[model samples]
Target: MANRIRASFRKSARSPRAGDGKHRKDVLDSLQELRNSIEKLDDTVQRFTFYNLQMAALRVGIDLSLFSSLVESEKPLAVGRMLRYLASFGAIKETEKDTFTSTNISSTFALLGFQAAICHYANTALQRAFNTTQPAFFWLQTQPEKLALFQEYLTTNCAGMSTFLDAYPVREHPTALHPERVFFVDAIAFRNRYRDLAGRVVVQDLAPTLQHAIQHAGVEMMEQDFFQLQGIKGAKFCYFRNIFHDWPDNKARIILQNTIEAMAEDSIILVDDMVLLNAGVHWQAAQLDILTMTMLAARERTQEQWDQLLQSAELKATSIQTYTASLEDSVIEAAPV
Candidate 1:
């Protein structure tokens, strides 16, 4: 009886081996799936890491102001030679070697007139992130570096207008009289502002030829707010660029009233700014309009807005011309009614 019981136990143990092969296959399948999942995760992480690194590199390059200097030079140069040039400009610290430390590179880029590309890219990125029509203006205001960069960028970019003006000849019309003197009005003088920040003045002593040209054309530089400007009794042409959008409808109206009080019927008001087009027209300009709305509670005007503003200001728009530079800005010619 004992021998028979032992034989039964041995047979039962051997029968379970038949199912062992199927169990092992199931385990192997799960292991393979896990391995494949892990490989996919690794790939995703690597791609994200690479994108972040590229953005960081761009930011570092821009904050160092290396790009602007390169653009200003209008030539290509080695990185080491560029570092030396930056040091000479007092934009960077002198190093024993020609190589610039990361710190120096970032500090130089933070300065005014050297951070356009950075701001442009950042703003565009921010707009994408929020999925909003405009770039967040509050972010720009809070970030002093971005604000400084934008102002500097505008200044540098706007200077190129000299070429555009030279290219287009101002027509002399008997009915459309040119001002005996054209005056530029702003609260802060460009020279004083530049000196205060940069420890140097630019265009303070206007170029001899430029001065002679202005004199010949009967133009003047007036450093005062248009609203507060005095001693103007004739039909002088008043020019404003990127100015009117800084205020709301009521405040802008007041400014226009001040101008009307100071000028004659024949006075021309030239507004150089962007006029927002329809939805499909220009996305960038439309985005800027929304951005202005958030920042200063202002906006880029539409044709209707422009017409309304001019009418409220007691001015009539006679002609409007658009220029396509890197960005589009318009020139509106108006006369006091």
Candidate 2:
């Protein structure tokens, strides 16, 4: 059996097909299952967080048809299903007359994702599970909430346009002499930061989405294919925000090569994407691990994987920073080898 499995693995490994291969698909599928299991296990121990408990209880309210009962009878659910209602409306509430009602807040809890999360833990007791107890290194490192500081920047400063909505606010302001020229390839045109955001912010994209956001005269916006040689040569930074993950490796390589051609020896190819850590992967990264596959025919990469890809393109990672817990803004600062 072991020999047969190894032989099968070898055969699958040798296939020239790109993207999802038989063995690779199996591995990723199993990985998704494992992460889901881990998430389920983690939920059990997070009850002390109060928010989790509240959400869990609300899901029970849904499963018991408590919301629907409250709406129909206009009475508080003493006990059953939140059906025949949109979860976004609200969860059921108890009134002064011992009747039930719902608020917008409860509606949030009733959302399918939230409801599913809550339902998963219904009738379940907290357990002393090891998976839950494991240190959330990824969460601790990124502290995603910090990115909220720039939340207002999106509307007031950025004019509410970007590739990924929740784009990070780059603190590296532009200097006087060699103002940084940031090439945002297929990213949100943050028009606000163009003047001094690390330097002159240039946007390279073909999407009509950026037209409105390209308000500033100083910020350069280009409607060119990234597969071709990018315009800005010897730029201080060529940034691809969540762009590579949406493309297969070969296509990603082409994009990288194009960017590489325009980069200086010292120019940095900053990849603002997820860096899949080998161990202790948080649930967000785990979900994204599969999201890339289903949503796009692409895959997120680990440090080793990234290194291999960069090396193949004659580039190297100089520094890496995890700016967000969900890895929404993790930066892989790379340079030509």
- Give the top-scoring candidate (lDDT): 2
How would you encode candidate 1's per-residue C-alpha lDDT over 1-337 as one tens digit per residue? Answer: 5466457545644675535877556555655665465554333333343343233344545665564554455234346433433433234444354433334444546556545555555423455554655434435545566666666655554453532243222334332323333223321342232222221111111132123222211224433444454345544345566777766777777767776777765566667777654222233343345445544667677677899999987777887777753235777878876
The global C-alpha lDDT for each of the candidates, from Candidate 1 onward, is: 0.50, 0.55
The runs of at least 3 residues in candidate 1 whose Cα sits more than 4 Å from the true structure, single-residue gaps closed, are 1-151, 159-169, 174-221, 229-231, 325-327
TM-score between model 2 and native: 0.46
Model 2: CA > 4 A from native: 1-199, 212-214
Candidate 2 residue lDDT tens string, 186-250: 33354443534445666776444334443556566677678788877777667786677767788
> Model 1: which residue pairs collide?
63-109, 64-105, 65-109
Q: Work out the TM-score per prediction.
A: 0.43, 0.46
Model 1 vs. true fold: TM: 0.43
lDDT of 1: 0.50
